[model samples]
Target: MEALGGLPEEAVVNSHVLQFYFHQALAAYRAGRNRDFRQFRDVMQALLVRPLEKDHIMARRLRLMQFLSRVEEGENLDCTFDKESDLTPLESAIGVLELIHTEFAVTQETMETLREMVKEAAVIVCIRNREFEKAAEIVKRHIGKEPKSQVSLCWNERQLLEHCLVCPMGCWGTEVPGVVSGMSYRVGSMTPEGVRGFLEKHAH
Candidate 1:
């Protein structure tokens, strides 16, 4: 960073510097270094085009990202971006994510990451709104029929919804979450030996 700082302001727009900032921002994002990611991302945005210039679409999108980054970090910050016609907050956020996905030249992995984030967010919003069936459909459409374990930035829906099912009928998500559960049969409780023994016994 110090070495880069030493370069003349005219050098800031160099393609190499732009790529450096973009890669650094991506690295910071993957590492969960929010502040570092934002710093590098802002620099990358400036290199790509004039940032925070309301008249420019790219600038408005970058501003939107700044708000989203805070929300992703569990911050309670108010997001005050331009709302799409008749769209709810969650819907507007999803629209922006899709728009950014189309506009940015990101890798497959990065694009998938952002897609998953918005998908998960949409599911959460659906669940909150008592649209459990909609949430399940969203998961089924893109998340597939296979049971997925919780990963970075992923919600533990299996364990969570399963637990919700175990609770009283008063629970919010017991319906469609359990309705959309995979029918895939597990071979083992914990180990291959257990599965083998059970299979052997059943085979008899």
Candidate 2:
């Protein structure tokens, strides 16, 4: 923290800076520096409004911070989707990002759904980016945002093996799924059944 403090203020103000601010605020909270925590927290919230920020893959995440800040302050949201964004509430949640202070009977229930959806979305983005530490950090910070279920996925040989790189820390389990599945064929690739037989012979 002291080393970071020695750098110019602009040093931490970059496209992917919120994670740093989030940690700084966390450190402040741990140190019992309420004012410093709030200051960093507020700065994180304010950064969401930058036009450049709105274009990134993590746009939803930046807005997510804004809503989280408001929620921390005990404010309620009537909507969660960005006013300027074309995505619907469902889309925003699916996109794992920003919406209105962000929530409404069925409408109200849907807000909770949105939160959960985005929680998973945030996890996916972290995992897809191979940010395992960040994934754990976020889950610890927002218990409600933790993934509700383990994920099961299937891919071609290349896709399946590549995900291993995403989990350098290693995971608890890996297994073949308990259902039959099939793949489609490209013009020149092996027949689907032939590929299946090949996989059976070379099965891991």
Candidate 3:
């Protein structure tokens, strides 16, 4: 907390407040609790995005301003996830993971209303500890007809050491196991129609 001006870089701890709030947001969205979801989204979005900005005005904060600015003008997710050399593996992982998690939290409710918006957006909900199974079950319930797969990201000391050797940046070390293509961010940025198609194709 001392480093980034009283806030952790990502602020997405495994069982922290953000995690709890995220689960709440997802629950609200799935239960069609739009009013609650919006309120929660607004608050959580503010906290989550406050520390992510490169620069901001004091006494007032802008959350997801970059995305908002882009969206207002009909731009897409054009930001690049370049490898930053300075940050340690843990730091980089936390930042990137939190970004993805926050993105999902803010959009989950809206995505429910317009599942097509996330049709091409691949839902990669990482499950570590018991929470993983719970999250997986929830996603399965929501994505009812689609085929879903689970990959383990839990590693012991030795395995982690080995993985770190290979993936030094720790961008996506052995902890996260899955078919990761170096192409898209998540779900490969499919259009709304494409998202629908992905679900349809996977439904069996």
Which has the greatest TM-score?
Answer: 1
TM-score to native of every candidate shown: 0.36, 0.27, 0.24
Whole-model lDDT per candidate: 0.45, 0.40, 0.34
**Residue 35 lDDT (model 1):** 78
Model 2: CA > 4 A from native: 1-13, 26-36, 45-56, 75-204
How much does candidate 1 score in TM-score?
A: 0.36
Residue 119 lDDT in candidate 3: 22
Where model 3 places Cα greater than 4 Å from the true spot, the runs are: 1-15, 52-204
Ranking by lDDT: 1, 2, 3
Candidate 1's C-alpha runs over 4 A off are 1-12, 50-77, 80-117, 125-204
Q: lDDT for model 2, please.
A: 0.40
Cα displacement (Å) at residue 54, model 1: 20
Among all windows of ten consecutive residues in candidate 1, which has the lowest summed lDDT?
A: 183-192
Candidate 1 lDDT tens digits, 24-105? 6545554556779768766765665532212343343453444344334322112333444433344445556566556544
RMSD, each candidate, Å? 14.4, 20.1, 17.9
User: Which pairs, if any, clash in model 3?
Assistant: 119-195, 120-195, 122-187, 127-132, 153-175
Q: Report residue 123 deviation for candidate 1 (angstroms).
A: 3.4
Residue-level lDDT of model 3, residues 1-204, one tens digit each, is 434456554542411444355446445544546566556556655666544433223112132222222122121222222345432222222233335335333344333433322321212222221122332333343343554232222234224323333443444545354433222322223223433332233221
